[model samples]
Target: MRLYEFEGKQLLEKAGVPIPKGFYVTYSAMGAVGADPELERIFDELGGREVAVKAQVLAGKRGKAGGIHFADSPEALQQVVEAMVGSELLGETVTGVLIEEKASFEEEYYMSLTYDTVARQPVLAISREGGVDVETFAREHPDKLVLRRFGPIVGLMPWVARDAAAEAGFRGRELRQIAAIAVKLWRVLVDNDARLVEINPLVRTADGLLLALDAAILLDGDARVRHPETNFPPRQATGRPLTERELIAQAIDEGDYRGVAGKYVELDGDIGMLTSGGGGSITLMDAVAAFGGRPANYTEYGGNPPAEKVYRLTKVVATKPGLHGLLIAGGIANNTRVDVTFEGIARALEEIRPEYPIVIRRAGPGEEEGLRLMRELAQRLGLDMEVYGADLPMTESARIIVEKAAAYRQKVEGK
Candidate 1:
């Protein structure tokens, strides 16, 4: 969940890090174009004509992608905003443009804080090399990079930060300033559930001030429930926005941690898929596609979650519009109880009462009871459905559902 630049800057400011005076603007790309009157007021508020215009998107290398530009006057600002807002940068749609007072810097530096796998804790990386790629700087000039890993309890003490700055060859004033920033950034990372908080080109202004010239922050997705103020919409793998159903599905597992029922990716097709296990979900998706069935989503539930979690997951997936059929299939489960999981699906079906066809093939502990429960539920609901067990291979069941869904879709469409 990589945040936009303006959002990151907000986090930085709240954590007591110095940043350039700025505000951000967002508008719809498809809407009619015009110079916003608010832009003029913001220009006056900045008390200067010299401003840096930056695109707000998840993509990186924004400068190289022409997402960064300078505007010296009202006319220039309008042109830059029009060119930037409602545009594309680095293949990402630009919905917002940040307008800030440009800085006159004497020197540039880099700073970052993130979880370190090897250290098994949060680590801070700082370097005198600022405007360049930090990874390349660390690799090429390891001597210039200073690394500090912090423990969970007594995290990132001030004196330790100052020592690290001294080790990086900074003298008194610079050492104190950079070390202060280090402490504030640690606060930001911990408080905001930020997986990565970075400042590239952390600058020393002409007035001898340390400031964050750029903010690159990525938030932890699992902790999103704790920070609704961020107001981020769920996004798919390719950056498209998630559907309402997908967002609902994701919220199901929040704070539960018992099992996973939130790994849902909505798709274009119509078959509602309720696959289980780890690799089993993906493998079933391929099987369905291989058999000419179009799955409405890719989702899973495993680790023997309570019936409540599965009921929520089932409700979300089964309720998707244009669902021609529903497929509930998974591999042989070692511990996931079939009766408990199937009861959740049955409960959701009772609420939805869909006329669409359904097929089920799950095998695990209490398989017979689960199958019987599903069969009885379908009969009572008067739904057209079939229940299978371990005897029917998952792939074969996939083929059967594909054929049935196709026939059902054709029948509905009068094709």
Candidate 2:
């Protein structure tokens, strides 16, 4: 789960990390003139200082996309807010804006605490050069990027932070300040069950103080059950709204906990995809797009979902309009029963009776039986379906579906 900027800053403040004084203004608050005396009062309280007007969205790179603005006075602040409140940035509606005091900084730095899967422990990364172009800086100056790994049980220690900061070239009081901020950031990450806690341009002010100029935090969704009090907001798509079919699929996924049957994201495309194995789904999506096939949606089901769950999900995908083809594929399964998945998909196909094109590529414990059942069902329904096993590469299946769907669409349009 991703935290909005304000929410992440709130958590950072709670954990003792310093942040600029700021408040949030929701879109509803920006009504007709004089509708919000409260906003006027907030501006008045700021006393005409330069402020940063930042759009509150889940995705990153907002700075480069004109989502962040500067206002030197109350009137400028109002204008900036008005311009950003209702507009869309990176396909996410700007529901609110963060009004913060702009700081005069002597230098900027980068810091982050995240779990390292390769090391199987938590890691802290810091760099003296930081900003919107931190990626480029890291790529060009890899030695400047300092990383320290800590045992998950022992956690981040103050001495370790100080050492890492010193290694990253911090000196004098700034070293202690950066180390303290790092310690607090680690606390925020652990206390909130976060997968990543990042602060870019952790600025050193002219007054010799350190403050977080920006924050980005991602919590571990799987660990949500442990922290029921934490309220993470819903995430929006990168480019568009969720379709009705996608919403139905979401409800079905949350209805039961039999297996992992969630993360259904809709896209603008004609090919409907039902895939399993998280990594495999990503690979197939890329292949489909690489071969000039537009994938309508991305669905991943694995860990042996129940047949009923598969049936509901498949039905949702099958009912999606403008689909020229359907691809049901996955990696060779270890625990998932191929026959059970085939039965559920067959049930959905029987109901929808799509005549365009269908491709199935699955191989697992019940491979032979599942293939036979699916082939028989396709023949009986007179469906244009082709079934493949482990012998065929997943990318090959993607190409076949794309070609078939294109041919089918041309024929139907001609008719």
Candidate 3:
């Protein structure tokens, strides 16, 4: 789960990290004319000072996309805020704006505390170069990036923070302040079960006070039960807001923990994909695209999900519009029963009877029975379906589906 900038800043403030004074103004609050008296009062409360109007969307690169605007006066701020409230930023609708006091910073630094999956440990990365393109800078000047890895047991020690800050070119009092912020940030990560806590442009003002100019926090979705107090809305993997179907899929998964049947992401394509296994799903998606197949959605169901769960998931996938074909392929499963998965898919097929060509390549436990069930159902319903097993490569199955979908399209187009 990714928290919005304002939410992340609130967490930072609570963790004792200094952030600029800001308040969020929703689109509804801005009114249609953006002439709400409350907005004017908010500007006045900030002493009519120079402020920044930042669009509060989930995606990044907002600055490059004109989502971040600077205002020297209340009128300019209101204009900027109003302009952003209704616009779209990075494919997400701008529903709110974070109006924050603009600060004069003498220097900007980069800092992030995140879990390094490869190392399986908490890592603190700091760099003197900070801004919107910190990533590009890091890639170009790897030496400037200071990294410190902390053990799971010891966590991020104060000494480690000091060492990282020193390496990032901090000195004396400023180094101590940076180290303190690092500790607080580590605490934020641990206390919130966060996967990443990043503060770009940890700026130092002319007065020598360090403050976070921008914040981003991503919590571990699986660990949500650990932090029952945090109420964040569901979001897609791309960080865009979830679609209605995606939300429904989430609810379906949450309702039953019997099997891992909840990995569904809607994409802009014509082929509906039902794949399994993490690596397998990725490979299939790439293969489908490589073969000129535009996948409508990505779905994974394994661990032998029940018939009802599979039925619901298949129903969701089969009903997606613009679907020219359906590809059901997966890696050879260890425990997931093929028959059970097919039963659910067959049930959904019996109901929806999608005209698109369907391809299946499932080979695992109860493989014969599963393939038989799918074959019988397709024959009984007079559906255009092709079944495969481990004998044929998954990528080959993807190619067949692409060809079949193309043939169907040509036939439909009457060309």
Candidate 4:
């Protein structure tokens, strides 16, 4: 979950990080900001000072895109807001603007607490130079950027934070101030289970106070169950609106921690897939494509998920209107009960009575019973299907499905 600037600011404020005071001007206030009494009254509360009108879009690099506009007074602010409210920025329509008091800062610095994959731990990064992309700045001026890795359990302590700030060239009161803010950022990360909490351009105002001018946050999608107050809309990994099947697949394992049956990404193709295992899913996708089977979606369910989860996932995958075949395949499971999992899948097929050819290639504990269950389902339904165990390699399973699906399509089309 990547929060909008206003939402990130809310979290920062709650954690005691000084941020430019701002209010969200929703698109509903686009033409009404200056003329409408209510909207105009809100602007008056900014004390008629210089303000920054920022487009509220998930797209990045707002500064270069004319998404951030400046105004010295209320009339100017209204005009800026009017121009921004409905404009398109980086392919995303601006839905609103975050109006904030523009800070009079002499120097800009960068700071963020981000999850580092290599370290397998969250690391706090700070820089003397700010207001630009941190990665670019670090590359250009590595000496100015400082990084400190912190243990997830111990967190960023006060002493280490102050030292890190000093290392970034801050001294005296400035060092103390930035160090305190750093700890607060760590709190924001841990408390929210966020993978990233960034304040790019941590500015030093003319008054010598530090205020965060911008924010970027990304929460762990898997940890979303722990935060109930959030209502962020579901967005595909590619930032597009999710399809109906994608949404259904996404919600399958919401509250259940038993196993994952909900990792799904919809694709443009005809073959439906229900695969399991971690990296195995990607390998299977590649195998299927290599064999000319266009997987309609990439989905995996494993770790011994309950039958209902698999059953739900099965329905979501198999019922796609244009599927020529359905492939239920995975590596030999280590702990996942194939018999139990297959029961759910078989039950779903019984209900769907799909005309498309189906393939089940799975092997693990209870593999015998599981293969038997699928074979029985095929016989009872008189379905076009093939059931296999570990005797056939996963790649071979993919080839079989592609061959069957292609043949079935030809027969149906009289080609």
Writing each residue's lDDT as its tens digit, candidate 1 over 172-262 gives: 7999999999999999988988999999989999989999999999898898889887776654545555678888988999999887888
Per-residue lDDT tens digits of candidate 3, residues 101-195? 88889898899999888999999999888875877887889899998998978788899999998988989898899999999998999889999
Q: Write the per-residue lDDT of candidate 2 for residues 1-415, one digit (tens) a residue.
A: 8888999999999998889988899988777684356656676666657788899988889999999998886767778899899899988888899998777898989999998899899999999988857678778888999999998888899999999999999999889999999999989998999999999989989988898999999988888889878767577545556767777788876757877766688887999999988999999999999999999999899888887888888888777888899999988988899998778878888899997799999899898988998899899999999999999987789999999999998998888
Q: Count the backbone clashes (under 3 Å) in each candidate.
A: 0, 0, 0, 1
Each prediction's Cα lDDT score?
Answer: 0.88, 0.87, 0.87, 0.86
Question: lDDT, candidate 2, residue 84?
Answer: 97
Q: Please give the lDDT score at residue 88 for candidate 2.
A: 90
- Please identify which of the two predictions, 3 or 4, would achieve the higher TM-score against the true structure: 3
User: Which pairs clash in model 3?
Assistant: none
Clashing pairs in 1: none
In order of appearance, the predictions have TM-scores of 0.72, 0.88, 0.91, 0.82
Error of 4 at 94 (Å): 5.0
Q: Residue by residue across 86-192, what tens digits does model 4's lDDT show?
A: 77787777778898877789999889999889998888898988888777778888988999887888889999898889898999999999999999999899888
The lDDT of model 2 is: 0.87
TM-score, cand. 3 vs. native: 0.91
